[model samples]
Target: MSQTINYQAQSPTHEIESKPFDEKNQVEHVNDVSAAKELSNFKMDAMEAEKAEHNMTVLEAVKAYPWACFWAFVMSFTIIMESYDVFLIGNFLALDEFKRQFGILDHNTGKLVIAAKWQSALQMAGQLGALIGVFLAGPLTSKIGYRWATIVALIAMNATIFVMYFADSLPIFFVAQLLEGLPWGIFIANAPAYCSEIVPIKLRAPATQVLQMFWAIGSIIVGAVTYHYNPMSGKKAYRIPIALQWMFPTPLLVLMFLAPESPWWLVRKGRLEEAAKSVNRLGRKSRLNANEIVAMMRRVVENEKEGSISYLELFKMPDLRRTLIVSGVYAAQNLTGNLIANQAVYFFQQAGMSDQTAFALGLITSALQMIFVMLSWILTSYYGRRPIYIWGTAFNTVMLFALGIAASVGKSNAASQAQASFGLIVSVMFTFAAAPVGYAIIGETGSIRLRPLTTGFGRAVYYIVEIPCIFLASYMLNPTGANLGGKCGYVWGGTATVCLILAYFFLPEMKGRSYRELDILFHRRVPARQFSKTVIGPEEDE
Candidate 1:
């Protein structure tokens, strides 16, 4: 048989390898080069697809989800209107027409002072409302959901804007303003929370900063419109700007219907499937698989479990206590004289500018502010939160100090133009540095689990400080002119200086840390000054 076999037809190795198996069962190894080539092609395809879907242009994404952009715009628009309303009053009140209409030109000094004080007083009421509203927002949202809470706040605030038209007496306007204050706090507390929570993390900074821009935009529009319309005509000329306020929020309310509830909130309520769908809508829908979605919910649920709903529990846990403190510090960031800056029209008049020049200057200042804020938004990602916080506050402190001296001496100097010009330059710089960082720090300092609570606490601090500052500023400027601004400059300058010390010593670089990681980092026992390095991943935090 061996002699007859055609041994040349097959190798002994091949024959041995195939001996145990049938023809159909014979195995073949794939070429290593070919297999690797196939895998590389597949990976490239996946990355390309991901980039296409996830890296959407802002315009394209807006078209796909108009509500997202619409809500963002509305939030921004409202702030603009607020700025316009506040600043316009200063210019109008300083005008001869406004004083004459009220029949007090002869002894207008007292009336003018009272008007400023009254406005500031109303602002104080609103600030008080803000403090209370922010403290209450967390529980209210938990009970009523963010959408409803937003609607309620908007309604209350906007309604007051409408009522301001009918306010004939100072007392009536005062009551209306106080009512208006309540909703302003609610809006401040909830809107950012809503906007920040819903937008995908990658776009968080821009979205929130855009809200700040809208506020600036509102200020600009208000300045321009009021310059032309002169809201103090005493014959309903003011209706146009005031009416615009009511008009802007109308569509915003409808847009909320399209906005899905927060997935974290949904999960907190135990609607796991709905939470997945909500998160998917915010994300590139196709990329998130069931397992990934479930994993996200599970982590959120675990965090919530670790963080109870009770306000009492907030102080009980070391992490929560740290979170509260960080958020409280964040609130003080707003206190660095930006709101007072917004009332620049009034201050300019006090600095001895004519009514028209004050309004025009207000416009110029606001436009510059808007430009700086946009720039800050870009730089925050490039430069990180710490650099902005440090440089911004430091520069602002210098400006505030310079402003105080300029305001103090300008009236007698005949170089009032130069002094006023220099002071204005410093203010512009302060606004430039503070605006973007103001919006950025709201979310950065706290854990993911503590976002709502901390945001509420921060806002509460904002309005609380805000109201008193406005009234004090009004009283100082109205009664004492240069002396008050000088003192304010000194006080605010010192405050900014304190902020600088805090920024260098305590404020951690929260620029790039993940929500989970921020949670762990803030919980460390190290002093806030050393937090930058002592935390396990200082570099990672940025």
Candidate 2:
């Protein structure tokens, strides 16, 4: 059985005059104290109401929000398109046919080899365009809404894929890669923000985790396709994978028209009625009170207006701390040696493995990553965010350092090969748990009005870090360059250790908080450790 209490009617702001504890009134006084305590508990319940129904379990929340889950799953395909190209380009770099078309002859080894500069350029071009797109996401999403922004991005992305498919020279390929990155940046910036806005607090982590899971799924598809097409010569082998990019965005574009606009975005734009309707659509069968949810959203929007929505505000007082934490978390993701996983096919090939063996290992890594991402969704829901993040960071640091040492010992040695392979697999598995959670955290940390801008800014910082990291990774791994191979892990490992310490001290637990409650907590300057236990009442001053 369930009961509903009207805590809103018993406003905590009402005052009770202090009276002397008299023997005649002692029983009444005791009753008064008990009632006050119960009221306090009720106030806490009201604050958490936005997070979930008064007493609903996570399973119940899922059963209630099937449409929300479906929407999240559909939006996640954008990540698949992004992930496909990430693995596709790396695998192509190691392909015999791709090498024959693009590589210069290395007389010493009597084999065609792509130069380190070209390889680095290929990866960095996308990052450069992604940086630009991230900066543009704020205005794009703000103007047209996430749905239309994504649709426009998809249209542009498909156009670029055609260019990439027909590209013959390195310069043309670079241009195509840069062009492809524009939409990817927009999708990455907006998709998780959309997921955060539409789903219940309990489901946010899982929904965003699904976004990352698709990334691994894309990698798996590319790995398998590239391996199967290994025997083909010239453009045919690489063209097939390049053409596959068209599959994701075309259907996603049409689906966006059917999707509802983000309720938060509507509220920010002063479309209150539309926002309420969006909320009802998203929370159709849920226990959530749509009117109450809209009211909460309105309160946050009104509060946000007190502080203007400017980029400079992101660095001002209360928002500054959040901006730093979110940006740093995104940067920390890159420092986990994920680039090595991104370039796994090439890394294995450079270490003297056959093309088939290298692609097979890449496929295995992606499969393991997909499995771990699903596991992370469950773990994130049960264990909360900070502990899992800390644990994953610690594990990544140790594995990277170990792999670096193994690579430094001797690349061709059987012992080194086994150690490096083991290190790559284990490090990636650990990384899946923490790395993707950063997106959910970034989405949750911002004020409702600034959500898109905050995520876009965070992603811009992400690409700023990624651009140099990708270039450095290509330099160290490309056979024509420094060829550090597994030793590159040592670089990222040292940085991951620093990120681990920062996360422990700064990343607040935001597992079950609504966007409105998060604004209050951040405004109040609550300590990270106390976020989960601290009870906030409506009348409490910010």
Best by lDDT: 2
Best by TM-score: 2
Model 2, residue 63: distance off in Å is 1.8
Instruction: Mark the regions of model 1 whose C-alpha exceeds 4 Å error after superposition.
Output: 1-85, 88-92, 95-97, 101-116, 287-294, 304-307, 319-331, 408-414, 480-483, 526-542
The residue-by-residue lDDT of candidate 1 on 252-278, one tens digit each, is 767666667766667667777887787
For model 1, the local distance difference test gives 0.61
For model 2, state the Cα shift of residue 482 in Å.
1.2
Task: Provide the lDDT at 60 for model 2.
Answer: 77
